[model samples]
Target: MPDTSFPGAWSVDAEGSAPPFEQLRARVLDLVTSGDLPAGFRLPPVRTLAEQLGLAANTVARAYKELEADGIVETHGRGGTLVSAQGDAARRAAQQAAAEYAAKTRSLGITEADALELARTALSLR
Candidate 1:
């Protein structure tokens, strides 16, 4: 059984090129799709996350909104947010494959851009 604890270490890079909301959204998506955060994980409240990451509550809310829109998470008023189990089997398989690819690519010291280009090339080949 996975911990399913609130993943508080998810942080924002204030100086990075990506907008804070986008960064937060991506981190949440990665956590869900990586299986580090299993289905049914409860996310920290928007205000709490904002305080932890030094972002505005609205920023975190926006990220949460995006995650909900993408079906990675579902929010219940007063009950908080939870990782969705809607695509459990498919998501688990995809995450496992992604983990394998990431492990292999990291062993070769591939940068994100290189990995993305590699994926793009592979997609084109298909």
Candidate 2:
């Protein structure tokens, strides 16, 4: 599990690169998607993640809310947030999309051999 700590002072990006809450959301999503954060892995509490990221507690709360809305994460009483097991649906969607891509690529003049290779390589990365 990644270590959790309080950041103490809030310092969101003034450059507008991405809102603090959005960045937090994206990072959590990527972590969950890449399997770096596995299913059932607990997330830092909103206050804890907010403090550690130098953000407002409300920002973290917003991020978690968005994650939950998208079915990427879940919350339970005071137990904290966690990656969703519903990730299976997301994986299925990705597989279907990949199948469509493979067909489209072949139709676009990509050789069957090359398309197969592409699918293999893409699935391998997952």
Candidate 3:
């Protein structure tokens, strides 16, 4: 079995502005990006982590699904989920988002220079 104990305590703030599943997803993503959960680190099974964190299995499952969709984690049949290589995963996710943004801007008839400027402004805000 994969280790149930992650590097730090994990909790879902039921009263927080974000939903529980999103909070969990963000926490796991933060861990991956921060190098606390290294590449190839297997995460606990959904039910097991759900029990530990007092969340519904579905909630944990949704978080894992979103993480996998974002390329931050890979799910193996019966082998469990493992963190992806941070640098590569982050780059791929960013590229995909940029592509989607570009498509949307084009569909909206935004000029290339305007789109580029909007992107630059968003990056600057970050």
Top of the candidates by TM-score: 3
Q: Give the per-residue lDDT digits (tens) of candidate 2, residues 9-112.
A: 33457466678888777677767777777788788888777776678899989989998887888899776787788745456667888889977996799988
Task: Please provide, for model 1 over 62-120, each residue's C-alpha lDDT reduced to its tens digit, 9 standing for 90 to 100.
Answer: 99998887678889987888888862544666688889988899899999789989978
A best-first ranking of the candidates according to their TM-score comes to 3, 1, 2
Candidate 3 residue spans exceeding 4 A from truth: 91-126
RMSD of candidates 1 onward, in order: 8.7, 6.2, 4.5
What are the clashing pairs of model 1? none
Which 10-residue window in model 3 sums to the lowest lDDT? 84-93
Better of 1 and 2 by TM-score: 1
- Quantify all predictions' global Cα lDDT against the true fold: 0.79, 0.75, 0.85
Q: Find the candidate with the highest lDDT and give its number.
A: 3
Query: Model 1 Cα displacement at 115 (Å)?
Result: 13
Displacement of residue 85 (Cα, Å) in model 1 is 0.7
TM-score of 2: 0.63
Q: Which window of 10 residues has the lowest lDDT sum in candidate 2? A: 2-11
- What is the clash count for each candidate, in the order shown? 0, 2, 0
